[model samples]
Target: MKKLIQFYLFIIFSIPCFSQSFSFEWTKQLSSTYFAEYIWEIATDNDGNIYGATDGGGIQTFLDTTFDVATSASSTVLFKINDAGERKWLRHITNSENGSIAVDSNKKVYSGGWFIGSSSLPPYTLTAGAGFGNSSYYTTLDSLGNFTSATKVFSGNSFLNSIAPVICNEAGDVAYIDNREFPSGFTYIQYHTLTKKNSGGTSWTKAFTTTDVVPLYIDPANNLYIKGAYTSAITVGGTTLTNSGGQDIYVAKLDGAGIYKWVKKIGGNHDEWLQSAATDADGNLYISGYFNSDSIDLDGIKLYAELTENNSFVAKINAAGNYEWAINLDSNAYHFAMNLLVDEDGNKVLITGRYTEEMTLGTDILTVTPDQNIYVARLDLSGNILSGMQITFPLSATIYDRKLISPESMLICGTFSGSVAFGDSTYTSAGGDDGFITKINFCELPATYYADIDNDGYGTPDTFTTACNMPIGYTNNSSDCDDSNNAINPLALESCNTIDDNCDGNIDEGLIIATITPASATSFCKGESGILNANTGVGFSYQWKKNGVNISGATSSSYTATKTGNYSVLITIPGSCNDISDETSVTVYNKPNATITNIDATNDLCFDTSIKLKTGNGVGFTFQWYKGATALAGATSNIYFATTSGNYKVKTTNSFGCFKMSTPYTIIKTCKLGESDSPNLQVLIIVLVALKCQQPIQLLKIVNFGNQSL
Candidate 1:
C-alpha cells in the first residue's frame, strides 16, 4: 500500500553553496493573459522539476485544455516544468491572482493566495453557491499536475485580507497565519490569527493584535514561529515586544498546544521590517530584513552597518533566541530580501533579494544593468560571503521563491518584464509581465594546486588534508618560501637561536632573544623555587620549554622553575627569528633533610621502661627509626619506641626521593641481685648428722648413743 504520509519542505532557492562554481542553465518565459500578470512564488520536488503559484496564463484550463486568458480578465495558475524549461502541465483555477505556494515530499503542490468570482475549478467552487465573488483558495496538485483537493477558505461576507507566510510541515499537518483588521480608529490595525491542524483532527488557533505580520514557519516538531512588524509596544502570548524605533521586527514561537515559548524583538530606532524567516533542520532561525539604521543591535553585539540606502540584514538566531551572527549587505538604492535559507547542517546559507543600483559582496562589487536586479549569495552560517553573483534579466525581475533540487542545481521562479537573461541566451516575455522559470547548475569544488613549501606542505585556503592529499611534495599548507628544505614547514618550530625556524618563507620575522640573569646556584633545597629572568628587548615573543617540551602558559619574561630539569627559553622577535637561551641544568635535591633527634631525656635504661626518639616532619619526607645496625620493625613514622635500649637512630627521605641516615645514640643498663641464694642452714644440718654418726659409734660402747642426744 502507498503510504499517504508526506512532508512539506520550506523551499529555499539554493545556489552553489561551498563550491564557488556556478552557471546559468536555462530560462523560459511564461504568460497566459493580456492583463498584467506575475508569478509570486516557486518550488521544486525531489525530481528537480520546477513548480510555483502564478496569476498568469501559463497553465491549462479546467477542461484539461490550454488556457486562453485573452478573454479572461485575470486568472490564477499553478505550473510545473522540467529541467529543460519545458512545461509539463498547467492548471488555471481562479480569477483573483494573488497567493503563496508550497510543496510536499510526494511532489504534491499547494498554491494559495486570493481569488475573485466563484472559481469554476474543481474543489474551489463557491462556498456561497455559483456567483461572481471573491475569496481565498488553497489547492493541492500531484507531481503529474492532477488536482487532489481544493479548499475555498473564505468568501461572500468578507473579502480575503492579507496572508502571512504559510508553513505546511507535512501532508495534513499545516499551520497558516492571516490577519483581519478590527474595528478601530481611522487606521486599520491588523489582528493576526493562526490556525493549526493535523490529520488526526487536532486543532488549535491563536490571535495576536499587532501592526502587520509576514513570514510564519513551522518546525518539524510542529512548533510555530512567526515574524511581524510593529509600531509600538505590543504584547502577544503574555510576552511583550517593544518597538525599537520607528518600526521593529517581532518574532515569537509557540508550541503545538498554542503555548508561548519565546518572543524576541529586533531593530533599533530607525524604520525596519522583516520580509521572511526560516528555520534549519536543527531549528536555528535565519531572518532576512531591511533596515535604515546606522547600526543594528543583535541581542547585544552591535553591528555598524553602512546605510547608504536601505541595507539588507541577515541574521542567525539559535533555537533559544541567542544571536549567533549578523551582517549588512549594503544595497545602494533600495533593497528587500525575498527569501533566506540555511542548509540542514547550518553550514551553507543562501540569501536572495532585489536591489537597485549596486551591491558590494566581499571584494566583488556588482552593478545592476538597469533599474533593479536579483541577487543571490552563498555565505557561511555566520553571514560571511564566500561567493555570489548578480542573477539578472533586462527591465526588472526578482526571484520570489527557490529550492535546492540537488547538490549542483537550483529551481527559481519570478515575474519578469521585456526579456529574461540566462547567461549567453535571453528569452523575451510571453505577454505583459510574464512568469519565469530558471535553472542554475553547479559543479564540485574545482581542483587547486599548491607549492609544497619546505618540501613539507602546499599552499591552499584549506588545511593539509583537503588540497594536498595528492601524491607529491605538494601540500595544501601555505606561504612557504623554501620548498626544498624540510625545516621550512609551517609546523617547524621557529627559534631565535637559529634562522628561519618557521617555514613561512620569512627570515627572523619576530626573533628577539631576551637577556636575563641566570640563577647563581644550579642546585637548591627541595622546597626552593628557582627563578629565571629574561632581559627585555624589542619585537620578541618568548616560549619557555622544559626538557624540549613546551610548558603550558609559560610565555612570560621570567619563569619560576618548580621541578629540576633542563630548561631553555626560545625568544624571537617579530618574524619568529628565534634566539634560544643556553639550556641550564637545575638539580632538585629530594633527599629527606631527615633530622634524627634523640628526644629521649634519659640516656640510661631504668626498670622496665621504653624510650621514643623524635624526628621533625616535612613535605615529601618519610622516616624509618633504627637501633644501631638493626632496623626496627613497624617503626616507619617520625617517632620510634625502644623497648630495650641499644644504639638508636632515624632515617628519612626528602622530596627528591633521596634518603639519609642519622648518627646512632646508645642507652646503658645495670641489673641488681635477689635474696633466694642463702645456703648457711644446709651446712649446719650436715655437720649435726656427722656428729650424731660419730657419737653413735662411741655410744655403742656407752648406752647406745646417749652422747648423741646431748
Candidate 2:
C-alpha cells in the first residue's frame, strides 16, 4: 500500500476542521502513472467551480471530459473541474517544485511556483505570471480557463529564491518569503526575506536573517504569514530568536508592505519540519508537520513526541500567534506527506496523511490493515477526535488537496491506487495510480424551530425550540400576534388589545398607542400658529385633525394649526393597527380690538365753549380718548372735553379686550368779543346820567362809528 496525503487545505478550507469530522462521502479517481510527488493546493470560486494547484506527471484522469482538450499534465499543472464533475480543464505549467493557487473576487485564477527556467527553451520563457522574468513564474487565467497574463522572474543578484509557498490575497496582492542564499566571507549563508508586489507593479522587499521560511497565507487585508524551521539563532527586526539547541519552527507575521509585526518560534530539543499550515476564517492557524525529537515545546508549553518513527504532529495557534494546543498524530507510522485544513467557522479540522501500524486518538484506535493505508481524521478546536467518523482508505493516497464548499461540506482531491471505498461507493483507478476527488459532509448543527402549541398558522414570539425539523404544532414563524387565539396571526387585523390584537410580532403596537408630543393644553395668539405633534408608534402614518374634522394636507408626525380648535391625530399603521391621539385644545386668544364709535363732541358748537365727548357703550373694557393719533392727557375715561379747535376721537372697549378708535371731529373758534371803538351815545346819555338810568331804559339804538354795534 502507498501513503496518504490530502490537503494543502488553505484556500476554501477557511473553516476549522476537527479530526473526528472527516466522513467519506463519495470518491472518484482519475488515472495517473506517477505518485508520491508534488505539493497540492486547491480553491473554489463563487460559482462553485473547483481548481487544483500542484504539479502532476503521467496520464491525467478525465471525468468524462470535464474541460476542453481532455488531457492530463506532462509537467507542472493547474486542474479545474465543475461543481458537478461534468467538465474539467487542466493546464501544464512549467517545471515547478512547489506551487500555490488562488482565485480573486473577479473569478481570475492565479498560479505560481518556485524554481523557473530549464536549460532548454528555458522554463521561464514558457511559464506565465503577472510580473515574471526568469527565476520564478506567475500566471493568471480567466474564469473559463482562458490565459490572461504571464511573467517569469529571474534573479540578477546574490539572493536565491527557495521553494517557499506563495499567496495571493483577494486584492490580488502577491506575497512570499523566499530563502536567500548569500555569501558572507568564505561561506554561503542562508537567510529568508519577504517580498510583496502590488497588481499595479509597486513592490517592496524586506530581508531577515532567519532560515527556512515558507510563506503560507495572505488574508484579504493583505496580511502575510510565513512558517519555517530553524537550527541556531536568528534575529528579526533587531530581536534575536534562539532555539533550544537542535531545531525549531518559527512563524513571521507581516503587513502588506513587508513590514514586520511580530515573529514567534515553536519546537523543542530535536528536529521539526513544517510541511504545511492552514488558517480558518478567523486567522487561527493549524500547522501540520513531522518532528523526530523526544520532547518539544509548543509556544511555552512542553509536549512529548513518540520516539520510534518520524511522528506527524499538528499544532494550533491563535490569530495572535499564541499556541493553543498540539497533537501528535500517527506517531508509529512514518509520514510521507500530509495536508491540514480548518473549516471556515474555525470549529473543525481535517488532517490527511499516510501512516503504518496503528492510529490512536483518545480511546479509539484503528490499525492499518495489512500494510500502509491512507488515513484521514477530523478534530475539533480543542484537538479531540470527533465522534462517529474515522477513515482509512485501502489504496495509497498522497499530495492531498481540500476545498470547503460550505460550512458543512468539503471537496478533497489526491492521487490514489487500486480501489477505495468511500461511504457506500467505491471508485477504482481508471488506469495507473490516478488522482481522485471526493465530496464529504461531516457537520452536525441543531436546527431552530418555533413553538406553536395552539396549532395555529403562527407561533408565539417568546417560545422556541431546536430540532432537525419542525415538530407537531411547531412552525418556523415567531410572529404570532396572539398565541392563544388562532384567528390572531400575522394576517389578522389589529384591534383593541386585551392581548395581541394582530400577529405582527408585536402586541398592541400601533393600536391604543397614540402618544401626543405635547401632553397638555396650550395656547396661541391670534395671527400666530400652533403646532401639535402626535407620537405614532413605529411603522405608523399620521393624519392630524382640528375639532372633529380632518385638516387637509395635514398628514405627518406633527401638524401646524392656523386656527383655534381641539387638535388631535389619527395614526394608521400597517396590519390595520390604528389609534386616535389624545385631544389638545388650543385656545387662540384674540388681541384687543378697539373702535372709536360714539364720539359725542360739541365740536361745531359755540366757538370758545368747551365740548364734552363720551365714548360709545361697550362691554367690560377700559377706554381712552385721543387727539388725532396722540392720546389726550388724563383723558383715560369714556368721556373727553375739547376746549380748543382740534381734531379729536374717543376709543371704546369691548368684551374681546380690543380698542377701536372713531372718526375724528374738528372744533373751531369763530370770533373774539371786542368793545366798540366809539360808542356814540346819543342824547339819551346826558339825561340818563342824571336820572341814573334807574329805569333800565337807556339808549337803544346808539350809533357807533362805522357799522359797529355797541
* Number of the predicted model whose TM-score against the real structure is largest: 1
Q: Supply the TM-score for candidate 2.
A: 0.49
In candidate 1, position 354 carries an lDDT of: 70
Off by over 4 Å in 1: 1-23, 57-65, 128-133, 156-164, 170-172, 181-191, 329-337, 354-375, 378-390, 442-710
For candidate 2, give the lDDT.
0.62
Q: Cα RMSD (Å) per model?
A: 22.1, 15.4
lDDT score for candidate 1 against the true structure: 0.63
Q: Give the 10-residue window scoring lowest on summed lDDT in candidate 1.
A: 1-10
lDDT of 2 at 138: 58
